[model samples]
Target: MNRTGAALLLVAGAGVIAVTLALWGQPLVSASGGIRLWVNSIWSPETSQQVADWYSVSHLVQGMLLALLLRALPLRRPDTVLLWSAFAIGVGWELAEHTDFVLDRFRATTLYQGYLGDTVLNAVMDYVFMLAGVALARALPVGASLALVAVLELASSLIARDSLTLSTLQVVAPQQAVADWQDAIRPARP
Candidate 1:
Protein backbone atom coordinates (compact mmCIF):
# COMPACT_ATOMS: atom_id res chain seq x y z
CA MET A 1 0.00 0.00 0.00
CA ASN A 2 1.08 3.56 -0.68
CA ARG A 3 2.23 5.60 2.32
CA THR A 4 -0.95 7.65 2.31
CA GLY A 5 -3.07 4.57 1.88
CA ALA A 6 -1.21 2.80 4.68
CA ALA A 7 -1.54 5.80 6.95
CA LEU A 8 -5.25 6.00 6.32
CA LEU A 9 -5.62 2.29 6.89
CA LEU A 10 -3.76 2.55 10.17
CA VAL A 11 -5.87 5.47 11.23
CA ALA A 12 -9.07 3.69 10.33
CA GLY A 13 -8.02 0.51 12.09
CA ALA A 14 -7.04 2.46 15.20
CA GLY A 15 -10.24 4.44 15.14
CA VAL A 16 -12.32 1.29 14.91
CA ILE A 17 -10.36 -0.50 17.64
CA ALA A 18 -10.43 2.55 19.87
CA VAL A 19 -14.14 2.90 19.40
CA THR A 20 -14.66 -0.80 20.05
CA LEU A 21 -12.43 -0.91 23.13
CA ALA A 22 -14.26 2.13 24.41
CA LEU A 23 -17.41 0.10 23.81
CA TRP A 24 -16.46 -3.54 24.40
CA GLY A 25 -14.16 -4.19 27.32
CA GLN A 26 -12.39 -7.53 27.00
CA PRO A 27 -11.93 -10.34 29.54
CA LEU A 28 -8.82 -11.44 31.51
CA VAL A 29 -8.12 -14.89 32.88
CA SER A 30 -5.12 -16.98 33.98
CA ALA A 31 -4.70 -20.38 35.60
CA SER A 32 -4.28 -18.32 38.77
CA GLY A 33 -4.88 -14.79 37.57
CA GLY A 34 -6.83 -13.62 40.59
CA ILE A 35 -10.56 -14.10 40.95
CA ARG A 36 -11.34 -11.30 38.51
CA LEU A 37 -7.94 -10.24 37.20
CA TRP A 38 -7.83 -7.77 40.07
CA VAL A 39 -4.28 -8.80 41.10
CA ASN A 40 -5.47 -8.45 44.66
CA SER A 41 -7.37 -11.72 44.87
CA ILE A 42 -4.23 -13.68 44.07
CA TRP A 43 -2.76 -15.23 47.23
CA SER A 44 -2.66 -18.95 46.99
CA PRO A 45 0.93 -20.08 46.47
CA GLU A 46 0.29 -21.91 43.24
CA THR A 47 -2.04 -19.27 41.92
CA SER A 48 0.17 -16.36 42.90
CA GLN A 49 3.24 -18.03 41.51
CA GLN A 50 1.39 -18.93 38.39
CA VAL A 51 0.06 -15.41 38.03
CA ALA A 52 3.50 -13.90 38.44
CA ASP A 53 5.20 -16.41 36.21
CA TRP A 54 2.53 -16.09 33.57
CA TYR A 55 2.65 -12.31 33.53
CA SER A 56 6.43 -12.18 33.54
CA VAL A 57 6.98 -14.70 30.79
CA SER A 58 3.92 -13.79 28.75
CA HIS A 59 4.66 -10.10 28.77
CA LEU A 60 8.20 -10.78 27.55
CA VAL A 61 7.09 -13.13 24.80
CA GLN A 62 4.23 -10.91 23.72
CA GLY A 63 6.46 -7.85 23.74
CA MET A 64 8.99 -9.53 21.46
CA LEU A 65 6.33 -10.62 18.99
CA LEU A 66 4.81 -7.14 18.90
CA ALA A 67 8.23 -5.75 18.18
CA LEU A 68 8.34 -8.05 15.15
CA LEU A 69 4.99 -6.82 13.90
CA LEU A 70 6.01 -3.22 14.27
CA ARG A 71 9.20 -3.93 12.35
CA ALA A 72 7.11 -5.30 9.48
CA LEU A 73 5.30 -1.99 9.27
CA PRO A 74 6.22 0.10 6.24
CA LEU A 75 6.25 3.27 8.31
CA ARG A 76 9.03 5.21 9.97
CA ARG A 77 10.89 3.38 12.69
CA PRO A 78 10.06 5.11 15.93
CA ASP A 79 9.90 3.19 19.23
CA THR A 80 7.24 5.11 21.14
CA VAL A 81 5.04 5.32 18.09
CA LEU A 82 4.05 1.69 18.31
CA LEU A 83 4.04 1.64 22.11
CA TRP A 84 1.89 4.73 22.43
CA SER A 85 -0.39 3.48 19.71
CA ALA A 86 -0.97 0.45 21.88
CA PHE A 87 -1.65 2.64 24.92
CA ALA A 88 -4.16 4.75 23.08
CA ILE A 89 -5.88 1.65 21.81
CA GLY A 90 -6.03 0.08 25.26
CA VAL A 91 -7.41 3.21 26.89
CA GLY A 92 -9.95 3.47 24.12
CA TRP A 93 -11.11 -0.06 24.85
CA GLU A 94 -11.42 0.68 28.56
CA LEU A 95 -13.60 3.65 27.75
CA ALA A 96 -15.58 1.65 25.20
CA GLU A 97 -16.46 -0.95 27.82
CA HIS A 98 -18.30 1.70 29.79
CA THR A 99 -19.97 3.14 26.72
CA ASP A 100 -21.01 0.03 24.80
CA PHE A 101 -24.79 0.04 25.12
CA VAL A 102 -25.07 -3.71 24.72
CA LEU A 103 -22.45 -4.41 27.37
CA ASP A 104 -24.04 -1.87 29.65
CA ARG A 105 -27.40 -3.46 29.10
CA PHE A 106 -26.02 -6.93 29.67
CA ARG A 107 -24.40 -5.98 32.96
CA ALA A 108 -27.30 -3.89 34.17
CA THR A 109 -30.16 -6.05 32.95
CA THR A 110 -28.49 -9.44 33.00
CA LEU A 111 -26.53 -10.89 35.93
CA TYR A 112 -22.98 -9.57 35.96
CA GLN A 113 -21.18 -7.99 38.88
CA GLY A 114 -17.93 -6.26 39.68
CA TYR A 115 -17.68 -4.88 36.18
CA LEU A 116 -16.42 -1.74 37.92
CA GLY A 117 -14.36 -1.03 34.78
CA ASP A 118 -10.65 -0.91 33.80
CA THR A 119 -7.56 1.11 34.74
CA VAL A 120 -4.32 2.50 33.24
CA LEU A 121 -1.96 -0.37 34.11
CA ASN A 122 -3.78 -2.30 31.45
CA ALA A 123 -2.57 0.28 28.96
CA VAL A 124 0.96 0.05 30.30
CA MET A 125 1.05 -3.67 29.55
CA ASP A 126 -0.26 -2.98 26.08
CA TYR A 127 2.86 -0.95 25.49
CA VAL A 128 4.99 -3.60 27.13
CA PHE A 129 3.58 -6.30 24.88
CA MET A 130 3.96 -4.06 21.87
CA LEU A 131 7.60 -3.64 22.77
CA ALA A 132 7.93 -7.38 23.24
CA GLY A 133 6.45 -8.10 19.87
CA VAL A 134 8.63 -5.51 18.22
CA ALA A 135 11.71 -6.93 19.87
CA LEU A 136 10.84 -10.43 18.67
CA ALA A 137 10.31 -9.26 15.14
CA ARG A 138 13.81 -7.85 15.18
CA ALA A 139 15.18 -11.35 15.70
CA LEU A 140 13.27 -14.62 15.22
CA PRO A 141 12.24 -17.74 13.25
CA VAL A 142 13.11 -16.15 9.90
CA GLY A 143 9.57 -16.26 8.43
CA ALA A 144 7.61 -17.46 11.45
CA SER A 145 5.04 -14.70 11.68
CA LEU A 146 2.35 -17.19 12.60
CA ALA A 147 4.71 -18.75 15.12
CA LEU A 148 5.15 -15.41 16.81
CA VAL A 149 1.41 -14.90 17.11
CA ALA A 150 1.00 -18.31 18.67
CA VAL A 151 3.74 -17.73 21.25
CA LEU A 152 2.24 -14.41 22.20
CA GLU A 153 -1.19 -15.95 22.58
CA LEU A 154 0.17 -18.81 24.62
CA ALA A 155 1.94 -16.41 26.96
CA SER A 156 -1.29 -14.44 27.24
CA SER A 157 -3.03 -17.49 28.66
CA LEU A 158 -1.28 -16.78 31.98
CA ILE A 159 -2.98 -13.42 32.32
CA ALA A 160 -5.85 -13.56 29.88
CA ARG A 161 -7.52 -10.24 30.38
CA ASP A 162 -8.76 -8.46 27.25
CA SER A 163 -5.31 -7.09 26.64
CA LEU A 164 -1.99 -8.67 27.69
CA THR A 165 -2.58 -8.03 31.38
CA LEU A 166 -5.32 -6.88 33.73
CA SER A 167 -6.19 -3.27 34.62
CA THR A 168 -6.44 -3.93 38.34
CA LEU A 169 -2.68 -3.64 38.63
CA GLN A 170 -2.93 0.02 37.67
CA VAL A 171 -5.06 0.77 40.72
CA VAL A 172 -3.46 -0.51 43.86
CA ALA A 173 -5.77 -2.11 46.40
CA PRO A 174 -4.61 -4.44 49.15
CA GLN A 175 -4.94 -8.11 48.35
CA GLN A 176 -6.49 -9.03 51.71
CA ALA A 177 -9.62 -7.01 51.14
CA VAL A 178 -9.88 -8.06 47.53
CA ALA A 179 -9.64 -11.71 48.50
CA ASP A 180 -12.11 -11.35 51.35
CA TRP A 181 -14.57 -9.51 49.21
CA GLN A 182 -14.24 -11.97 46.36
CA ASP A 183 -14.59 -14.89 48.70
CA ALA A 184 -17.67 -13.42 50.31
CA ILE A 185 -19.53 -13.36 47.02
CA ARG A 186 -20.83 -16.32 45.07
CA PRO A 187 -21.18 -16.57 41.34
CA ALA A 188 -24.67 -16.25 39.85
CA ARG A 189 -26.14 -19.42 38.34
CA PRO A 190 -25.64 -19.34 34.59
Candidate 2:
Protein backbone atom coordinates (compact mmCIF):
# COMPACT_ATOMS: atom_id res chain seq x y z
CA MET A 1 0.00 0.00 0.00
CA ASN A 2 1.00 3.68 -0.43
CA ARG A 3 2.28 5.93 2.34
CA THR A 4 -1.05 7.67 2.87
CA GLY A 5 -2.86 4.38 3.00
CA ALA A 6 -0.32 2.99 5.42
CA ALA A 7 -0.52 6.02 7.70
CA LEU A 8 -4.28 5.82 7.65
CA LEU A 9 -4.09 2.17 8.52
CA LEU A 10 -1.85 2.86 11.51
CA VAL A 11 -4.16 5.54 12.83
CA ALA A 12 -7.20 3.34 12.31
CA GLY A 13 -5.52 0.50 14.11
CA ALA A 14 -4.68 2.69 17.08
CA GLY A 15 -8.23 3.95 17.29
CA VAL A 16 -9.56 0.43 17.18
CA ILE A 17 -7.31 -0.73 19.96
CA ALA A 18 -8.19 2.26 22.10
CA VAL A 19 -11.90 1.86 21.64
CA THR A 20 -11.81 -1.86 22.15
CA LEU A 21 -9.90 -1.53 25.39
CA ALA A 22 -12.05 1.29 26.62
CA LEU A 23 -15.17 -0.62 25.80
CA TRP A 24 -14.28 -4.15 26.84
CA GLY A 25 -11.21 -3.87 29.06
CA GLN A 26 -11.62 -5.44 32.47
CA PRO A 27 -12.83 -3.31 35.32
CA LEU A 28 -10.15 -1.77 37.52
CA VAL A 29 -11.78 -2.92 40.77
CA SER A 30 -13.43 -6.20 39.88
CA ALA A 31 -16.73 -7.02 41.51
CA SER A 32 -14.91 -9.60 43.65
CA GLY A 33 -12.49 -6.95 45.04
CA GLY A 34 -9.40 -7.68 43.00
CA ILE A 35 -7.41 -4.82 41.45
CA ARG A 36 -6.34 -4.39 37.85
CA LEU A 37 -4.12 -1.88 36.15
CA TRP A 38 -2.67 -1.59 32.73
CA VAL A 39 -0.32 0.61 30.69
CA ASN A 40 1.76 1.00 33.89
CA SER A 41 1.45 -0.87 37.12
CA ILE A 42 3.65 -0.28 40.13
CA TRP A 43 1.75 -1.07 43.33
CA SER A 44 4.21 0.88 45.43
CA PRO A 45 7.26 2.97 44.68
CA GLU A 46 9.52 0.84 46.84
CA THR A 47 8.57 -2.48 45.28
CA SER A 48 8.92 -1.57 41.63
CA GLN A 49 12.02 -0.52 39.78
CA GLN A 50 11.23 1.17 36.54
CA VAL A 51 11.87 -0.61 33.29
CA ALA A 52 13.84 0.85 30.38
CA ASP A 53 10.79 0.98 28.17
CA TRP A 54 7.58 2.85 27.83
CA TYR A 55 5.37 3.55 24.82
CA SER A 56 8.02 5.81 23.30
CA VAL A 57 10.44 2.98 22.63
CA SER A 58 7.89 1.44 20.37
CA HIS A 59 6.83 4.86 19.14
CA LEU A 60 10.25 6.00 18.00
CA VAL A 61 11.00 2.68 16.38
CA GLN A 62 7.65 2.92 14.65
CA GLY A 63 8.61 6.37 13.51
CA MET A 64 11.76 4.96 11.98
CA LEU A 65 9.63 2.32 10.35
CA LEU A 66 7.40 5.09 9.10
CA ALA A 67 10.43 6.93 7.82
CA LEU A 68 10.99 3.93 5.63
CA LEU A 69 7.44 4.28 4.34
CA LEU A 70 7.63 7.88 3.13
CA ARG A 71 9.68 9.26 0.24
CA ALA A 72 9.63 13.00 1.16
CA LEU A 73 12.23 12.60 3.80
CA PRO A 74 14.30 15.54 5.07
CA LEU A 75 15.84 13.33 7.81
CA ARG A 76 16.10 16.51 9.92
CA ARG A 77 12.98 18.56 9.37
CA PRO A 78 10.82 15.47 9.33
CA ASP A 79 12.36 14.21 12.56
CA THR A 80 11.74 17.55 14.24
CA VAL A 81 8.25 17.67 12.88
CA LEU A 82 7.70 14.09 13.96
CA LEU A 83 8.96 14.92 17.42
CA TRP A 84 6.65 17.89 17.68
CA SER A 85 3.85 15.86 16.20
CA ALA A 86 4.36 13.15 18.78
CA PHE A 87 4.19 15.72 21.53
CA ALA A 88 1.07 17.22 20.05
CA ILE A 89 -0.51 13.83 19.63
CA GLY A 90 0.30 12.77 23.16
CA VAL A 91 -1.13 15.99 24.49
CA GLY A 92 -4.20 15.44 22.40
CA TRP A 93 -4.77 11.96 23.81
CA GLU A 94 -4.33 13.31 27.30
CA LEU A 95 -6.94 15.88 26.54
CA ALA A 96 -9.23 13.29 25.05
CA GLU A 97 -8.86 11.02 28.06
CA HIS A 98 -10.16 13.82 30.25
CA THR A 99 -13.15 14.44 28.07
CA ASP A 100 -16.58 12.85 27.74
CA PHE A 101 -15.42 10.20 25.33
CA VAL A 102 -13.37 8.52 28.06
CA LEU A 103 -15.27 9.76 31.10
CA ASP A 104 -18.57 8.32 29.95
CA ARG A 105 -17.11 4.85 29.77
CA PHE A 106 -15.63 5.15 33.25
CA ARG A 107 -18.86 6.36 34.80
CA ALA A 108 -20.98 3.71 33.14
CA THR A 109 -18.58 0.92 34.08
CA THR A 110 -15.56 0.37 36.24
CA LEU A 111 -13.12 -0.33 33.44
CA TYR A 112 -10.73 1.86 35.30
CA GLN A 113 -11.09 2.29 39.07
CA GLY A 114 -10.30 5.92 38.62
CA TYR A 115 -10.12 7.66 35.32
CA LEU A 116 -8.25 10.91 35.07
CA GLY A 117 -6.47 12.36 32.11
CA ASP A 118 -2.85 13.46 31.93
CA THR A 119 -2.03 16.36 34.17
CA VAL A 120 -0.19 19.55 33.27
CA LEU A 121 2.99 18.16 34.76
CA ASN A 122 2.88 15.11 32.54
CA ALA A 123 2.11 17.34 29.59
CA VAL A 124 5.23 19.42 30.24
CA MET A 125 7.43 16.37 30.47
CA ASP A 126 6.05 14.98 27.25
CA TYR A 127 7.27 18.07 25.43
CA VAL A 128 10.62 17.83 27.17
CA PHE A 129 11.01 14.23 26.09
CA MET A 130 10.03 15.04 22.55
CA LEU A 131 12.66 17.78 22.44
CA ALA A 132 15.16 15.44 23.97
CA GLY A 133 14.38 12.89 21.29
CA VAL A 134 14.77 15.48 18.55
CA ALA A 135 18.07 16.70 19.99
CA LEU A 136 19.34 13.14 20.33
CA ALA A 137 18.39 12.36 16.76
CA ARG A 138 20.27 15.46 15.64
CA ALA A 139 23.46 14.65 17.55
CA LEU A 140 23.93 11.05 16.46
CA PRO A 141 22.81 8.49 13.96
CA VAL A 142 19.13 7.70 14.40
CA GLY A 143 19.43 4.36 16.19
CA ALA A 144 22.25 5.40 18.55
CA SER A 145 20.36 8.51 19.62
CA LEU A 146 17.29 6.42 20.16
CA ALA A 147 19.29 4.20 22.50
CA LEU A 148 19.80 7.18 24.81
CA VAL A 149 16.04 7.16 25.20
CA ALA A 150 16.24 3.82 26.99
CA VAL A 151 18.91 5.07 29.38
CA LEU A 152 17.03 8.28 29.95
CA GLU A 153 13.76 6.48 30.32
CA LEU A 154 15.31 4.12 32.86
CA ALA A 155 16.95 6.95 34.74
CA SER A 156 13.72 8.80 34.58
CA SER A 157 11.95 5.72 35.93
CA LEU A 158 14.38 5.58 38.89
CA ILE A 159 12.98 8.88 40.01
CA ALA A 160 9.99 9.35 42.30
CA ARG A 161 6.59 9.37 40.71
CA ASP A 162 6.29 13.10 41.23
CA SER A 163 9.72 14.19 40.14
CA LEU A 164 9.86 16.95 37.59
CA THR A 165 11.72 14.65 35.23
CA LEU A 166 9.89 11.48 36.24
CA SER A 167 6.14 11.76 36.36
CA THR A 168 4.03 8.66 36.90
CA LEU A 169 0.69 9.01 38.62
CA GLN A 170 -0.94 5.66 38.10
CA VAL A 171 -2.22 4.17 41.31
CA VAL A 172 -5.64 5.17 42.47
CA ALA A 173 -5.89 6.86 45.89
CA PRO A 174 -2.17 7.40 45.55
CA GLN A 175 -1.91 10.76 47.23
CA GLN A 176 0.36 9.29 49.85
CA ALA A 177 2.38 7.55 47.20
CA VAL A 178 2.47 10.76 45.27
CA ALA A 179 3.60 12.57 48.37
CA ASP A 180 6.21 9.96 49.07
CA TRP A 181 7.34 10.07 45.49
CA GLN A 182 7.50 13.83 45.71
CA ASP A 183 9.56 13.64 48.86
CA ALA A 184 11.80 10.94 47.52
CA ILE A 185 12.50 12.82 44.32
CA ARG A 186 12.96 16.40 45.50
CA PRO A 187 16.27 16.15 47.33
CA ALA A 188 18.07 14.21 44.64
CA ARG A 189 16.63 16.28 41.83
CA PRO A 190 17.40 19.57 43.52
Candidate 3:
Protein backbone atom coordinates (compact mmCIF):
# COMPACT_ATOMS: atom_id res chain seq x y z
CA MET A 1 0.00 0.00 0.00
CA ASN A 2 1.16 3.53 -0.72
CA ARG A 3 1.81 6.04 2.05
CA THR A 4 -1.30 8.04 1.28
CA GLY A 5 -3.47 4.98 1.21
CA ALA A 6 -2.08 3.70 4.46
CA ALA A 7 -2.48 7.08 6.04
CA LEU A 8 -6.11 7.22 5.01
CA LEU A 9 -6.70 3.74 6.42
CA LEU A 10 -5.21 4.77 9.73
CA VAL A 11 -7.53 7.76 9.91
CA ALA A 12 -10.55 5.62 9.14
CA GLY A 13 -9.53 3.08 11.74
CA ALA A 14 -9.14 5.79 14.34
CA GLY A 15 -12.59 7.09 13.53
CA VAL A 16 -14.03 3.64 14.07
CA ILE A 17 -12.37 3.45 17.45
CA ALA A 18 -13.71 6.83 18.45
CA VAL A 19 -17.20 5.78 17.46
CA THR A 20 -16.83 2.63 19.46
CA LEU A 21 -15.78 4.60 22.49
CA ALA A 22 -18.82 6.79 22.12
CA LEU A 23 -21.16 3.86 21.78
CA TRP A 24 -19.57 2.28 24.80
CA GLY A 25 -21.01 5.14 26.86
CA GLN A 26 -18.77 8.12 26.30
CA PRO A 27 -20.69 11.38 26.22
CA LEU A 28 -21.04 12.98 22.76
CA VAL A 29 -21.10 16.60 23.93
CA SER A 30 -22.32 18.73 26.78
CA ALA A 31 -23.24 16.60 29.77
CA SER A 32 -26.64 18.17 29.40
CA GLY A 33 -26.72 17.68 25.57
CA GLY A 34 -25.13 19.49 22.64
CA ILE A 35 -23.34 18.66 19.41
CA ARG A 36 -22.00 21.09 16.86
CA LEU A 37 -19.86 21.32 13.82
CA TRP A 38 -17.48 24.24 13.20
CA VAL A 39 -17.51 25.13 16.92
CA ASN A 40 -18.86 24.38 20.32
CA SER A 41 -20.89 26.97 22.14
CA ILE A 42 -19.36 28.64 25.17
CA TRP A 43 -20.43 26.66 28.19
CA SER A 44 -18.47 28.96 30.46
CA PRO A 45 -16.05 31.83 30.18
CA GLU A 46 -13.05 29.54 30.32
CA THR A 47 -14.44 26.46 28.63
CA SER A 48 -16.13 25.79 25.32
CA GLN A 49 -16.41 23.01 22.83
CA GLN A 50 -15.74 25.52 20.09
CA VAL A 51 -14.28 23.95 16.99
CA ALA A 52 -11.22 26.06 17.63
CA ASP A 53 -11.08 25.97 21.39
CA TRP A 54 -7.82 25.97 23.31
CA TYR A 55 -7.95 22.22 23.58
CA SER A 56 -8.49 21.99 19.84
CA VAL A 57 -5.43 24.12 19.35
CA SER A 58 -3.54 21.72 21.56
CA HIS A 59 -4.35 18.99 19.08
CA LEU A 60 -3.05 21.21 16.32
CA VAL A 61 0.14 21.82 18.24
CA GLN A 62 0.50 18.12 18.67
CA GLY A 63 0.16 17.74 14.91
CA MET A 64 2.88 20.30 14.30
CA LEU A 65 5.16 18.47 16.70
CA LEU A 66 4.32 15.19 15.05
CA ALA A 67 5.15 16.66 11.67
CA LEU A 68 8.53 17.69 13.02
CA LEU A 69 9.12 14.18 14.30
CA LEU A 70 8.05 12.53 11.06
CA ARG A 71 10.29 14.85 9.10
CA ALA A 72 13.21 12.83 10.35
CA LEU A 73 11.93 9.86 8.38
CA PRO A 74 12.81 9.48 4.70
CA LEU A 75 9.26 8.86 3.57
CA ARG A 76 8.01 9.73 0.09
CA ARG A 77 5.65 12.20 1.69
CA PRO A 78 6.21 12.81 5.34
CA ASP A 79 3.08 14.93 5.65
CA THR A 80 0.90 11.99 4.76
CA VAL A 81 2.64 9.86 7.29
CA LEU A 82 2.41 12.60 9.88
CA LEU A 83 -1.32 12.89 9.38
CA TRP A 84 -1.79 9.21 10.05
CA SER A 85 0.61 9.32 12.95
CA ALA A 86 -1.24 12.25 14.47
CA PHE A 87 -4.51 10.41 14.06
CA ALA A 88 -3.10 7.37 15.77
CA ILE A 89 -1.78 9.46 18.61
CA GLY A 90 -5.07 11.30 18.93
CA VAL A 91 -7.02 8.05 19.02
CA GLY A 92 -4.71 6.61 21.62
CA TRP A 93 -5.10 9.72 23.70
CA GLU A 94 -8.88 9.61 23.49
CA LEU A 95 -8.93 5.97 24.54
CA ALA A 96 -6.55 6.67 27.36
CA GLU A 97 -8.72 9.51 28.56
CA HIS A 98 -11.54 7.02 28.99
CA THR A 99 -9.44 4.74 31.13
CA ASP A 100 -9.83 4.58 34.88
CA PHE A 101 -6.26 5.58 35.64
CA VAL A 102 -6.39 8.78 33.62
CA LEU A 103 -9.88 9.61 34.83
CA ASP A 104 -8.89 9.03 38.43
CA ARG A 105 -5.89 11.27 38.01
CA PHE A 106 -8.10 14.04 36.65
CA ARG A 107 -10.42 13.64 39.61
CA ALA A 108 -7.48 13.90 41.97
CA THR A 109 -5.74 16.76 40.23
CA THR A 110 -6.77 20.38 39.81
CA LEU A 111 -5.87 20.62 36.12
CA TYR A 112 -8.83 18.60 34.96
CA GLN A 113 -11.18 19.46 37.76
CA GLY A 114 -14.71 18.25 36.89
CA TYR A 115 -13.34 16.49 33.87
CA LEU A 116 -15.16 13.35 32.84
CA GLY A 117 -13.83 12.95 29.31
CA ASP A 118 -14.42 14.02 25.74
CA THR A 119 -17.71 13.31 24.10
CA VAL A 120 -17.89 11.10 21.02
CA LEU A 121 -18.40 14.04 18.71
CA ASN A 122 -15.66 16.03 20.38
CA ALA A 123 -13.22 13.16 20.23
CA VAL A 124 -13.86 12.73 16.53
CA MET A 125 -13.63 16.45 15.94
CA ASP A 126 -10.36 16.62 17.83
CA TYR A 127 -8.80 14.22 15.36
CA VAL A 128 -10.00 16.44 12.54
CA PHE A 129 -8.59 19.49 14.30
CA MET A 130 -5.24 17.78 14.65
CA LEU A 131 -5.29 16.85 11.00
CA ALA A 132 -5.89 20.48 10.13
CA GLY A 133 -2.80 21.32 12.13
CA VAL A 134 -0.85 18.66 10.35
CA ALA A 135 -1.96 20.13 7.05
CA LEU A 136 -0.79 23.56 8.13
CA ALA A 137 2.56 22.27 9.24
CA ARG A 138 2.99 20.43 5.98
CA ALA A 139 2.02 23.42 3.91
CA LEU A 140 4.23 25.94 5.71
CA PRO A 141 7.97 26.07 6.27
CA VAL A 142 9.26 24.68 9.54
CA GLY A 143 9.81 28.13 11.02
CA ALA A 144 6.30 29.18 10.14
CA SER A 145 4.85 26.04 11.65
CA LEU A 146 6.74 26.67 14.85
CA ALA A 147 5.49 30.23 14.89
CA LEU A 148 1.93 29.04 14.42
CA VAL A 149 2.25 26.69 17.32
CA ALA A 150 3.59 29.45 19.50
CA VAL A 151 0.77 31.78 18.55
CA LEU A 152 -1.87 29.13 19.19
CA GLU A 153 -0.36 28.18 22.51
CA LEU A 154 -0.19 31.77 23.62
CA ALA A 155 -3.76 32.39 22.57
CA SER A 156 -4.95 29.27 24.34
CA SER A 157 -3.35 30.32 27.61
CA LEU A 158 -4.77 33.80 27.43
CA ILE A 159 -8.30 32.72 26.58
CA ALA A 160 -8.76 29.20 27.93
CA ARG A 161 -6.75 29.40 31.14
CA ASP A 162 -4.89 26.39 29.79
CA SER A 163 -2.50 25.42 27.03
CA LEU A 164 -0.48 22.36 26.16
CA THR A 165 2.40 23.47 28.35
CA LEU A 166 0.23 24.55 31.23
CA SER A 167 -1.80 21.35 31.14
CA THR A 168 1.35 19.30 30.89
CA LEU A 169 2.92 21.08 33.83
CA GLN A 170 -0.17 20.63 35.94
CA VAL A 171 -0.34 16.96 35.05
CA VAL A 172 3.32 16.19 35.56
CA ALA A 173 3.95 18.32 38.65
CA PRO A 174 0.62 19.58 40.03
CA GLN A 175 1.68 22.95 41.36
CA GLN A 176 -0.73 24.77 43.62
CA ALA A 177 0.02 28.16 42.15
CA VAL A 178 -0.82 27.07 38.63
CA ALA A 179 -3.95 25.34 39.81
CA ASP A 180 -5.08 28.33 41.85
CA TRP A 181 -4.52 30.75 39.02
CA GLN A 182 -6.31 28.58 36.54
CA ASP A 183 -9.15 27.93 38.92
CA ALA A 184 -9.64 31.61 39.59
CA ILE A 185 -9.72 32.41 35.92
CA ARG A 186 -11.60 29.49 34.43
CA PRO A 187 -15.35 29.87 34.09
CA ALA A 188 -17.44 27.93 36.55
CA ARG A 189 -19.12 24.87 35.00
CA PRO A 190 -22.86 25.08 34.62
TM per model? 0.36, 0.34, 0.81
| Predicted structure with the largest TM-score when compared to the true one | 3
- For all candidates in order, the CA lDDT equals 0.42, 0.39, 0.69
Lowest-lDDT window of 10 residues in candidate 2? 44-53
Identify the superior model by TM-score, candidate 1 or candidate 2.
1
Question: Model 1 segments beyond 4 Å from truth?
Answer: 1-69, 78-81, 98-114, 119-145, 152-190
> Over the stretch 19-42, how does candidate 3's per-residue lDDT look in tens digits?
787777875566655444444222
Q: For residues 33-119, what per-residue lDDT tens digits would candidate 2 score against the true structure?
A: 433222242233211112222433333333333333321465555644554455455445434545666665533422233444322
Tell me which residue pairs clash in candidate 2.
Answer: none
| Ranking of models by lDDT | 3, 1, 2
Which candidate comes out best when scored by lDDT? 3
lDDT by residue (100-152, candidate 1, tens digit) is 46345424421123343332334334334444454565567647755756665
Query: CA lDDT of 82 in candidate 2?
Result: 57
Candidate 3 runs further than 4 Å off: 1-7, 36-52, 73-80, 187-190
Predicted candidate 1: what Cα RMSD to the true structure?
12.4
- Output the better candidate (1/3) by TM-score: 3
Clashes of each: 25, 0, 3
